[model samples]
Target chain A: MENVIKIRGLTKNYGKNRGVIDVNLDVAKGDVFGFLGPNGAGKSTTIRSMLGFLRFDEGSISILGMDSVRDHEKILRDVGYMPSEAWFYDTMRVSEVIKYAADVRGLDCAQEAAKLCERLKVDTHKKIKELSLGNRKKVSIVCAMQHRPKLFIFDEPTSGLDPLMQRNFFNLIDEYVRDGATCVLSTHVLSEVNRYCRHAAIMRDGRLMMLEDTNIDEDAFLKYYMDEEEM
Target chain B: MRAVFVREIRLNMKQLIIWSLTVGILGLVCILMYDSMQGDMKSMADMFSQMGAFSDAFGMSTLSIATVEGFFATEVGTVHGLGGAMFAAILAIGIISKEEDGHTGEFLLSLPISRRRVVAAKGGCVLVCLAAFSCVCALFYALGFVMLGEDIPFSKLAVFMAMQLLMNIEISAICFFISGVSPKINIGAGLGVALICYVYDLVGRVVPDMKDYLFMGPYSYANASEIFSGADIAVAGVAVGLVITVVAYVSTFVCFDRRDLAS
Candidate 1:
């Protein structure tokens, strides 16, 4: 299978601190790839570099066979991205926020957005500021999924979601994957990787410690977390 | 681009209305009060025109405050000029930086649009809002003239307003550049720019040596008293303002495109 994302020698830094050092990664098309890391482990930094949001010190990132920096606009057309925290225009209604997202992509996503909202149980009439964290996450999910892009990049997607909503979100992801879409799910949750990911990469201290198939036992995954805690 | 433009306009609508109305109403009230203060102003104009440096700074030596035209020029002119500059500065200064400050830049920049396009769309929003503000305030001034049954000084008013628009655009362009380079919204710095420019113009008028270099500031060409007194427009000042506006506007696009946006 062809790779949808490719990174080589990726390095980013903030002064003396490490961001990501000499990192290399690839996510093949149609694969559910889990990027697991603890807070401050540089998962978000690597993801942002891939999305052309940050200027890395040294690296090359290609997404959907296009340069992340040079062809950013083209790559975004077929990529759906959801940040860890969903911050929107607070005064706008949920429906309006969704519409704005769709409008920027120049897509008619009303039907898809409505279906997503129904499944997620989002109140379209309420202002964004009026929604709970879970509800706001639901809105972010709807906005990301409505356009039905070929790839989805979700960072800590289930943090604010309740158990039920988390199940719904995974179900939605499963549906997209079944339709031949690729996904890069960045999260610290091991169970989510065990349940959904086919391939997973463990990151620690701005380094990729291991990349393996999810067939590994839960105890093996827990060892990586435990080792970090001990250190 | 249109999507971002429309969204910015919608987001900024409330601010536009509030700033425009506050300045507009203040100008209208001052225009209305001219009738009640006519007698007192007639005597005051003579005293004011003879106050040397103070008179020169406020343009009382060139335009008497006894007549409605002079009153509008000195009073309503100062109000609109200062208010418009501050509004333009405040609006443009926060526009780009506020995205990061509010944590909305992640959502916005993630869209399938380039940073250059985003900057262009926001620049369009600032221009449109400033134009609308000028029009609304101009209408209020016109209404006041109608109620008082005075001749509307159409030509002079047009020149004054056009110059004021250019001045505001110059101020806003500088602030827009500042917003692009800054990580957070700096309202204090924005207001400070406007205040400093106004003071520069006031001091330059009274201090003879500074008069020649007054074109360096935006307020020189937009001076109300000079326009109403039938003095020629300061072409050099206007040209310098336009040049600064273009340079700053272009710099914003260049700087923002290279920025590493905060998540």
Candidate 2:
């Protein structure tokens, strides 16, 4: 399968500190790529650079074979991104934010938005500030998934979601992949890696620890990592 | 850019509404206070002293509040100047900084827009908001005259409001510039801008000899109080204010585009 996202020697530096250093990875089309890392492991940094939010001192990023920065606008048209932090105008109700997002993308995803909101049990009429953490996550998910972008990027997508909603999210991704969309999920949730991802890249301290298919269960992988640390 | 602009507008409207209401209430209270003072006050000198104590920041030299021109200075300068400056500072502080503060920039940046476009669009929204507020204030001022049973010339009102409009853009630009440069601080940019303006006002008041060099002071407006008399407009000051706005806005964009966002 062709890669949805391709990176070669991607390096980003914030002054003397390392943001991401010599990182390389590829997420295949129609594949659920779980990009796992510890806190401050450069997963978000790498993802942001791929999305062109941060400038990299060295390397190349190709989104479906188009240069990430050069074709950023065109790529964004069909790329659904959910940032780790959920932000919306507090005065705006959930529906209004969704409408605003949809309007920006020129997508008539209202019915889809309604379905997602209902599925996640998010109150569409309530202010974003008034919503609970899980509900706010639902808001982000609904907006991200509603547009049906071909390439999906979710940064800590399940951070505020309850277990039930998280399961719903997995099912939603399954359906999306079945329809031939690509997804790159940046998260440390091990279960999510086992449950949804066909490909996984583990990162630690601004570098890739491993890139492997999930041939073994998550417990075995955890044991191996722990055993390696002890050694 | 338009898509981003539209969203910026949606966000700015809520802010504009809040600022408009607060500023409007303050103006109304001042008008009410002015109405109540007629019976108790002995002379315009007493009134100017009282008002000076209340709003020394707005006046260059105390004037008789009883006279319409002095009333305009007190009402427009001190009342609107301080309030308007504060209003502008707060508005500018958020325009460039709020998205990053709320972590919304991460989400928005991931979209197809460039950093430059984001900066320009966001800055443009601030200008739109300021313009909208100016229109509302002008409307209320006209309403104030009607309530007082005064028949002021529309042309004079236009000239006065025009100078205010120019001054406001300058204030907003400086505050917004502060926003882009200092994101970790909450409304620190606005407070800083207000302080700088207040200092300029002080220097203008304390040193009349240096008035040639310190045109930035709101006191400059005071020195040219006759400009609003429907006689002659000070086109030069307005031109200087425009230049400051442009430079401040451009600096803000440069700072925003180069900074690391995910951090």
Candidate 3:
């Protein structure tokens, strides 16, 4: 498989505060890569930097062989991103927000968006402010995936989703991954990575601690976190 | 960019409508009050003369407050000056900062668009709304003057309204520039700019030495006395306002393009 994402020596700092440091990562086409980390482990920082939201002080990032920062718009043309904390214009209706996203990206997403809304049990008529957290998350999911881009970057995407919806969401992503789309799922949920990902990278204190094939290092994976917990 | 512009206009439509109504209603009220105040012109002018400090602070120091244009300038124009400045500030600041404050910056910045385009789209929307607001106020103002049989020339009214819009843009651009650079925002910058202009205007009028430096303040540039006099509109003031507006917008584009947006 071709490498879809490549990062080397990535570092970002927040006024002496740790953001992310010397982070390195690669995700191949058709790979369901799990980026696992504890809370405050700089998982979001890394993801944000990769998406060119936060500028990195050191290193380079390329998506589909294009520079992430210099060619962000081109990269985003085929990238679907879902933030860990979903947010939207409060006054906009669910349908309007999704439509606006689609329009901005120049995608004809009405059919896909409507279908996703139906599957997620989202009410399109409700203003975003009127929706619950879970419903808002659904809206975010629909907005991110409606365009059916080639790559998906999801940051703790299942946080507010109910179990059944979570399963559905995972299954939707799985379907895409099986169809040759690449995905990077950032989550702290160990079982999720164990079940869905072939390979995973573990992060701690803004550093990558391990990258291993889930099946081959399943025992070691369990041991590493357990030992870290004891420390 | 079009999508962002459309979305901004839609989101801010209610606020724009309210502001429009406020400006229009104020214009009508000023015109209506002219009838009662016109008869006591000499006494009213004498009373304003005595309260020199008060008149200067609120921009009532210029022409006689008895003429239709003078009354409108002193009474209605004061409200428009302050109200428009505040409105512009709020609009500009809210354009960029609202996303970050509301926690939507990550989602917005993650889109398949450049940050520069996003800022440009916001700027365009603000300008559109500002233009619409100025036109609405001018329409109502002209209507009031005509209804009361006042003989104000259309060209003069047009120039006055244009100056008001230009002054509002200058304030909005300054606040917008502030928003582009700041990571976090509250109403402080917007309110601060408006309050500062008010104070600066007052000081410029009361102190003879500051008169030379009055152009630094937008209120002085949009002075009602200058507009109603044969001068029609202050060409130098408009030139200065344009310079400030252009510089502010350029700064905004440069800063927003490079600033690290906080989520």
Candidate 4:
């Protein structure tokens, strides 16, 4: 299978602070890849580098067979990215925010956006500031998924979601994946990985500690997480 | 680019309206009060003309304040010039940095648009807002002249407004460049820049030694008193201001393109 995302010798530094170091990763096409890490495991740094949001100190990123930096605009045309934090123009209504996203891509995503909004129980007429955290997350989800892009990159996507909404989010993901789309879900929630991911990579201290199949014995997985926490 | 441009204009519409009306109404009011203050201003102008540097700083030494044209140049000009500069600074200073400050950049940059295009679109919005601001203030001044049945100094007024627009563009460009380099919005710094430029021009006009270097400040070319008194427009100063504006805008694009944005 072709790789949807490929990273090699990826390294980034924030002056005196370490961002991510020698981080290499690959997610195959149509695979539900889980990037598991703790709060400060450099997961967001790596993801941002992949999306060309940050300039890595070394190595290169190729997404959808194009250079991340040189072809940044072209690559984003088919990628749906949900940031860890859902921040938007506070004065804009939820609906206007959604439309602005679609307009930037020059695509008509009204139907998909409407469906996602209804399923996620988002209030389209309310201003973004008026919405709760969960509602804002729902709006972000709708904005990301509405275009039906080929690759979906979600950074801690379920943070502010209620359990029921989380289930709905996964259900939406399942439907999209069924249509042959690939997903890279970066989250610390182990249960989410075990239940949804086919392959998982555990990262700690700005490096990848392990890459394994989710079907491994439950005991071994717990031990890996337990061992990291103890250290 | 069109989407970004449209959104920026919409986002700033409320600010544009507030600043334009504030400055425009103040200018109109000052103009309307000119007739009632004529007798007092005639005596004051005589005293002011002899007040040495203080009179020169405000152009009272060269332009009598007893007439409507002189009154508008000294009073309404100061109001609009200061107000317009502040508005331009505030508008452009946060246009780029606010994205990272507010965390909206993550969403905005994720779209299928390049960083250069985003900057260009934002620059376009600044130009539109400044143009609209200048037009509105001019209309208010015209209304005041009509209300008083005073003949408008069409030629001088045209030159003054044009120079003011260019001055605002230069101020906005500098603030825009600062916004590109900064990680957070700095309204205080933007206001500071405007005030400093105003003071430099004021001092340059009064001090003989600083007079030759007044072109370094944006307000030098946009001085309404000088324009109304039939003094030669500061062609060299206007040219230098345009050059600085271009350089600042180019620098902004270069800096913003390379910097690592905050998450």
Candidate 5:
């Protein structure tokens, strides 16, 4: 399998505190890679560094065979990102916000975005401030997926979503991946990772604890968290 | 860049309107009151002259209260000089910090555009809005002169307004640099810059030894009284202000590109 994302010795430090340290990761082309971690395990920090949203103190990240920092515009052009928290301009209607995102991506995405909104049961006419948390997440999903990017990077993409919507979201990801796209989903839910992702990487204390296939022994995977609790 | 610019302009339009109305309506009111105070110019001037520190702080020392231009230089100047700088500070500081404050940095910074482009687009929006606010003030000044039948020179007023706008840009750039590097410190940066400018202006006028440091404050660069008195533009002040504006913006762009954005 060809690697779509290659991160080596990626280190980010916040003053005396550690953000992510000596982290190395890779996601193969057309592979659904799962990044699993508990709260404060540096999952979001690592994901953000990959997108060039935050600069790292050491090491490198290449997305689609291009340096993420040097070629950020090029990489992001074909990448979809859904942050852990969904936020938008409060005064903007959902439709306007989607349109704005579409414009930024240089896409004629109205038709696609509208279709996503319809499928996700999102209200496009309401001001963003009026949307519920779930609705906001749905809006973010539409923004991220409207262009049908070649790679999807989702940080806790289903946190505020209902179970049904979560299933629907996974189905959407499945549809895209079947068309040769790749996905990296970060979540703490091991079952979700097992059910949807082919490979999983677990992180703890700003470090990678494990990287293996999801078909591994269930007891061994449970022991990793069990060991974490003991520590 | 175009998308960011358009979004910024749309988001800040309400604030622009509010600030412009505050200054514009206040200018009109002050001009209307000038007529009532015309007959008591001697008494008013004497009263202002007696309050040494107060008169100097408000630029009422050399300006007579009877003349429309003099009254504007002293009264409207204090308001716009301080108020305009404050508005600009809030605008620039909020440009970057608002993303973090609203927890939208992840969404915004993740866009395909570079951080440098983000600064350019957002900063351009702020500059435009500030310019528009200054234009509104100038419009009100022209309206006041017409309504009061005052024969103020348009050329001098234009020079003063230009100076005022430059001062605002300088102040905003300073705050932008602060917020760009460390968005969490936005409140401190905004208030700190404002307080420093106010103190420098006060000290320059009240203390004999601190007069040399007059350029430290934007107040001096935008001195409406001197401009109204037909004094030639202060090339030194303009040069210094422009330099500061340029340096601050360059720093903001570079820092934002390298800085770690908060999640």
Candidate 6:
């Protein structure tokens, strides 16, 4: 398998407080890679650094064979991102936001977005501020997924989604990985990992505790977490 | 960057419209009032003396208001002072912080552009809107001259415009820097700050002692009736503008790079 992301000795600080500390990881192409962590476990910090939204004091990050900082914009074009909290302009309708997103990525997602929204049970015509949290999540998901990107980086993407929708999302993600797309998903939903991810990394308190390749049910995964945290 | 610039301009339509209409109508009304009061003063000093107490309160006697040039002085210092300050502050604060406040900044960062490019594109949008808005005010100025027949010097009109542009650009640059650092809701507070400075400008013009302190106001350069009296470009004004724009751009770049993506 080809390497899609390679990080070495990455460290980041926020005004003397630690953000990410000497982190290193790799995800192969065609991966459904789960980044497992509770809140404030450096999941977001590591992701931001990967996107070139944060500065690191020491390390090298390469994505798709390009230097992360030097080729940030070009690399971003090849990836789709679903932020932990996707926000919208209050004045813009769901359709407008999705359309603008597609345009920004140099794609025309209008027709695709309409179909996607319908599948996700989202209304495209309403203002963003009027939508429920779950609907807004669907909007962000549709926008992020419409580009058919080489890599999909998501941070807690399933938070506002209902259980059924999450299961549907897992099916869609499985299809992408089967088709050779790469994924880096961070979420507290261990079941999502059990459903789709081939590999996973567990992080805690700004440290990577382990990276695992396992087949386990949610019941077993929690038991595993308990044993590992005790270590 | 170009696409970003285009998008910013498209979204800025309502702001441009409101500022243009609001400033244009007020300018026309002022011109009509100027027509009614034209040559009513016996002398330049007499004009100063008649409003001596009121002028003393606001600082209007540094140069003469009796001549057409003096009329330009009054217009640039007063109209542009109040209106331009609010316009610059409101637009600048809205451009950057509005995205963050609404949680759109994170989504915007996901696009294929550097944060520097994003800031630059929005800054360019500011200049573009400023240019178009200036032209609208100029059109109203021409109409004012054509309809009112006040015989204000054509040269003085250009000087009035140049001075207004300088003030607007300077204040807008300051507001942009603040937008990068402050929370989105703080924009209204920034506009309030601009208004307070407007009062300072009104004071600086009538009081020469206040001239030294006029640096406190964004439009204080309009107080240059002493130097701009003969159409001097005021290199000091240019230098000040360069300083403000440069500092704002640098601070904005640094802030955007380090701040967490809110959306």
True contacts kept of each: 0.86, 0.55, 0.86, 0.82, 0.80, 0.73
DockQ of 3: 0.84
Q: Check candidate 1 and list the clashing pairs.
A: none
What stretches of model 3 exceed 4 Å from their correct place?
A215-229, B46-62, B232-236
Q: Please report how far candidate 3 places residue B84 from its true position, in Å.
A: 1.0
For candidate 1, what is the TM-score?
0.97
Q: Write down the lDDT that model 3 would get.
A: 0.83
lDDT of 3 by residue, B1-263 (tens): 89999889988888898998897888788888898778898787768857766676554566678778778777777777777888888888878888888899888887888998998999999999999888888878888898889886677667677777888999999999888888667578798998898788788778777877777777766766567654545566668878999999999888887777776
Candidate 3, clashing residue pairs?
none
Interface RMSD of 2: 1.8
Q: Write the per-residue lDDT of candidate 1 for residues B127-246, one digit (tens) a residue.
A: 999999999999999999998999898999889889999999999999999999998999999999999999999999999999899999999999999999999999999999999999
TM-score of chain A of each: 0.95, 0.92, 0.93, 0.94, 0.94, 0.91
Worst 10 residues of 3 chain A by lDDT: A216-225
Models 1 onward score TM values of 0.97, 0.87, 0.95, 0.97, 0.95, 0.87
CA deviation > 4 Å runs, candidate 6: A211-213, A216-231, B37-47, B50-76, B183-185, B192-220, B224-231, B258-263
lDDT of 6 by residue, A115-183 (tens): 677778788889998987787888888877887778899988898899888877777777767877899
lDDT of 4 by residue, B82-195 (tens): 999999999999999999999999999999999999999999999999999999999999999999999888898889999999999999999999999998999999999999
Q: Whose DockQ is higher: candidate 1's or candidate 6's?
A: 1
Evaluated on CA atoms against the true complex, candidate 6 attains a DockQ of: 0.57
Q: On a 0 to 1 TM-score scale, where does candidate 6 land against the true structure?
A: 0.87
Individual DockQ of the candidates?
0.88, 0.51, 0.84, 0.88, 0.82, 0.57
- Which regions of candidate 2 deviate over 4 angstroms? A217-220, A223-230, B1-15, B21-66, B218-224, B229-232
lDDT of 3 by residue, A1-231 (tens): 689998899888888799888988888899888988777778888888888777789989999889988899999988899987799988788888899899999888999898888888889999999988888889999988899889999988888889999999988998888888999998877778878887788887788855656653556555545546574
Q: For candidate 4, lDDT tens digit of each residue in A1-231?
A: 899998999999999998999988888998899997667779999999988789899988999999999999999999999998899999999999999999999999999999999999999999999988788889999999999999999999999899999999999999999999999999877788889999889777789855656765656655545644574
State residue B252's C-alpha deviation in candidate 6, in Å. Answer: 2.8
Give me the runs in candidate 1 sitting further than 4 Å from their true place.
Answer: A215-231
